[model samples]
Target: MKTVICLVHGAGHQPLHYKYLIDALRRHGLTVAAPPLPTSGYDDASATKTHLEDVARVREYLVPFLEQGYEAILVGHSYGGRIITQAAAGLTGEERAAAGQDGGVVALVYIAAFTEKEQPLTPEILGVPPEDVNPATKLLWPEAAIRAMYHDIEPGRANEAVALLQRQSPRDLDGAAVCKSSDVPVPKRYVACRQDRVISFGTQLQFAEAAVAKVVAELESGHSPWLRDDGIRAIVDCVLEFSRRRQDDV
Candidate 1:
């Protein structure tokens, strides 16, 4: 069966934002499953659903693939890292196979994303200094963050990216995700965005270290690494490399 990449989107942004990456992966003969988080709706002033809700949303997409005997690769971008970590909790090949189940999550890929830690991951935690940050933290489109988040992308794509930016909840960032890094004992890799403003290079290293991540791939893009010309392919290539190791180990 083909490897299916289950994409967990970032906060505020919907799955559609992953269209470019998804299409590229598909063209390479890979399957992609990108879902919009429940918290991604616009004008959702009262969106109180936590990261667990987002986890459940991802599981909904993965379970179907597992049922059909296909390996699912959980790939999270930015805040999607929190959701994928929680969603993948207790769901691994060894555990599932031991329980007489099959086709579990094989690996994790974090693209400029968060990792398991005691405290909830916030912008401050990821190296965005709190000096001039917002209290509500509800960032509007085309904000200064874009300058840092997508600095490397072509200037023409700015408006398109701005249009996709939505209001992410501070509660979600401040609240701890449901799962721990140790909870999901699977081979993983961290695709660090070298020039990421949202999560600095040093901060990304910190998260990877905390998770004890097996591999790390550095990209020369901004916070949103997928915008780089070779961004999505590099990620898929890294996953394939991990997959090879997984097969060899077994």
Candidate 2:
């Protein structure tokens, strides 16, 4: 079966923000899906959406591909990590086969995302104050946002990426991980951004260890590593290597 890589974005972000990384993945002859979450967008709709809606949106988008026998590899970023974990429940390849489906999720890859290893996102965890949220849009890290999410990115490009930021529901930060990370039966890998200010490197390691990620890769970038060429290459290499390892295991 073919593999489909689904890249889930974090709060206040859309697929456009990951254009370089997505394009690179597709260039490798891989089918990639980068869906915008219901909890994020530039409208009032996003303010009302919650974690459950985010998970449902992803699963709903992938259902057609799964039924078509295309095995999926879910890659979550930041808040997306929790969504992937829950969205993958009972959707493993084996589980799908048992249910008479041709394909399903085969693995999980997290990039500076939340997991069962950590508590709900807090101001302290983000290295920001509670007041950092935008009053009008409810977006996180509104002030000095570049420092927290794109410090390692080049100035010109980082500004372009930040211009696409949208509103993120505050409810997501308080939502609990309904499913245990260990309970998700699949090959797991974690990509930790070494210079990430939004999610610190030390905290990323803790999440990876807690989830018992079989593989851990490091990139010399901040939270939004996909914004640059070298960072995108590093992430692409990590994912491709992990996919190969997964195939070998099977």
Candidate 3:
């Protein structure tokens, strides 16, 4: 059975934003599952949803694939790290095998995402005042988003990405911190964005350290690393490397 990479988008982002990276992975003969979070919708109910709801949604989406005997690698970006961490619990290959299932989550990949097991992701954690960053009440300001998320991206593409930004739930940000990666029972990898203004390089290191991730990649890019060609290649390389490791183990 082919391994599937379930790519979870960050806060304020939809799966469409990951098209380039997803396409590149597919071109390499890899199966990819990029699902949009419910919190990324523009509806009022979406704005009110929490991170746990997003986790539930992702877990539900993976059921059919798992039932078909396909192993999965949960790949999270930005706030998605929290979602994957929670969703992968009790879904490990070993755990599923014990239950007479042949397929389950085998690994986790975080792309400049939040992984702190203790710190709840709130505006305060993001270093912004609550009044300035209310996702439930307003959408991301395009120019500011470009400056923080796409600084290293080309101007045109950055603008386009900003335009695709959706309203994310503020309540999701207040969701409780996830369990430690050690508790998840799967190998973990983290891709650190050095030039990231939102999630700084130092913070990425801290999160990786806290999670005790087995692999870490340092990239000189902004928050959205996939916006650049080299960044996309690097991510694909990382995913492929993980696949190779899984094969070797098998």
| Per-candidate clashes, comma-separated | 0, 0, 0
Error of 2 at 20 (Å): 0.4
Tens digit of lDDT per residue, candidate 2, span 74-104?
9988889888888888888878888887888
Q: Please list all clashing residue pairs in model 1, or write none if there are none.
A: none
Candidate 3 segments whose C-alpha is farther than 4 A from its true place? 116-118, 127-139, 173-178
Query: Lowest summed-lDDT stretch of 10 residues in model 2?
Result: 116-125
- lDDT per residue as tens, model 1, 143-184: 565665766777666557768767666556446657787788
Q: How much RMSD separates candidate 2 from the native structure?
A: 2.1
Tens-place lDDT per residue, model 3, 83-189, is 89888888888889999988999888899987653545655666544555544445546666776788799887888888888887767755574456778888889
Model 1 regions more than 4 Å off: 117-137, 173-176, 243-250
Q: What are the lDDT figures for the candidates, one per model?
A: 0.74, 0.81, 0.81
What lDDT is reached at residue 128 by model 2?
Answer: 69
Candidate 2: Cα lDDT at 32: 94
lDDT of 3: 0.81
